[model samples]
Target: MLSLAAESWMLYGIACVVLICRYVSRWLQLGSVSRYQIEDYIMISVFGFYTTLLVTMNIVVHYPTNLIQPKDVPNLTPELVAARIYGSKIVVIVEQTMIMTIWGCKLSLLYFYHKLTFGLVQEWAVKIVAAYTCITWLLMEVLYFLVWCRPFTEYWAVPTDNIQCTAATHHLLTNFIFNVSSDLFIMCIPLPLLIRSKLPFAKKLMLCLLFSLGIFVILCAVLNKYNSFKHYNNAMWTYWYIRETSTAVYTANVPMCWALVRRIFNLRAFNSPDRNGIAKLPETPNIDDVPATIGGGEFRKQTTTPQHIMSAE
Candidate 1:
């Protein structure tokens, strides 16, 4: 039987491929394998966490396993029933862990966005947004699980038995709402600053297109919330959840793939034009004279003064 676990693993492979391309292209751009940026480390670590989430989901419950029809419950072996209960418990934990996986991807994107911005004012603004988003994500993840199933073990038990447990629709809706909104906000945060950049019309259009790719991530987040309607049905939930979560990772990695695109095309896409209609060569900017703009978006000429001859007359 096809299972969400199988599908998620497939997406994991795809994510790894994209990440490999991102890293290789980055190194190629720098003309060296030794140099690494802070975002590179964070992305690698996020991929590690993503891998763990995929692996854990499959191992804990064999969640993708086909179930015997309910009519056959009376004929089931005691061992099989016990196994199902154990798997159910594991599912609870897996759901909780999934939050961490999603948040890791979001945080990685936020850091990447922060790295791309310049100016002390802009940098702090992005940092503050990042910090507030982090706090909101943490709180959402915590409350979604705990408040929804106080004495957390009850989530698994209540699914099959009539034990007291919180209603899930509201919680699911709340979580999905937050997820979609956050995804949209993060993707939109850079638009104003980018729109105001001094880049040429074509460059600005291309950059916007590059960042606008996150609109796919926003779609994934919306669909993710839509699928929560099936929260009580594992088969339906797994079917949609796999796509939703995988898409989260997929969208997160797509923008990073720009490095590979640039490398493959041998395009100095970010370089600005010089006065002679040639690409400006890179130069070290003096702190005092440098504009608050980042290099790829603007090419301010280095200030030079001609020497004046002085003679005693």
Candidate 2:
């Protein structure tokens, strides 16, 4: 448990730094925080929930909980049972915050995709995926609070006969399915666009790699569910929960930091011809600066600027 706490905090710290950079990149690109896009603000809110999850998970680890086997339940004192019940309640908070943090990242990515695909046929695909993501989140919440555990109090009931209430096997399964599938759907939105763009093969590959970081997030989700199912008695899934949320936060923000990166390094390779046939970077990066080759070549004749070429890379 000590090791898990340490790992969780370490990952959370890294995520914080990445998110700070993401905001700085956006601020620099857009001139001020007032000009920040919707996705940028969404991620900020998600980070708030991420912080809450980390704090709640700490409480869960340190607090007593009735996660013991049936044989051990008889041994618990009234005071100990009460403590366990309180811890069990904290567990629900952890679960809810985790879901919110992960899904919030998903929503941020969908909005970014919506911006990326705007003015192109792919915009419709982004809209459809966004709807699907939102619907899945709603259904998952319903299954969690209303369908899976009846009476709700059973979730923290001490020495309860209903294992499902405590272990939350059904909720974990449904969450895993929803989490992984939504991640896959969001990832699919950018790959084909990057592939079809007339940019250099290396740049395309690099951009695709940036978007593909979602794969790691998916892997973390799988590990989280696997451990929850296979080792529920020991509460081993907590470590992976932290890892999964941290990875999701990272994947969502890293792509947006490219503009800052380019500005810091002064990378000139992104330069392309404008209407006057002169190649240069924009004074402030914006989605409009992206080369027309991205959306099925529809923006080919558009003025070229690398300001926000891969705003959500």
Q: Which numbered prediction scores highest in TM-score against the true structure?
A: 2
**In candidate 2, how many Å is residue 80 off?**
1.5
Q: Per-residue lDDT tens digits of candidate 1, residues 3-34?
A: 76768777878887888886776565444667
Cα lDDT listed for each candidate: 0.57, 0.78
lDDT of 2: 0.78
Task: Give residue 169's lDDT in candidate 1 (0 to 100).
Answer: 58
- Candidate 2 lDDT for residue 165: 83
For model 2, give the 10-residue run with minimal summed lDDT.
288-297
lDDT top scorer: 2
Model 2 bad stretches (over 4 Å): 269-313
Candidate 2, 3: how far from true, in Å?
1.4
Report the error of model 2 at residue 259, Å.
Answer: 1.4
Q: TM-scores across all candidates?
A: 0.74, 0.88
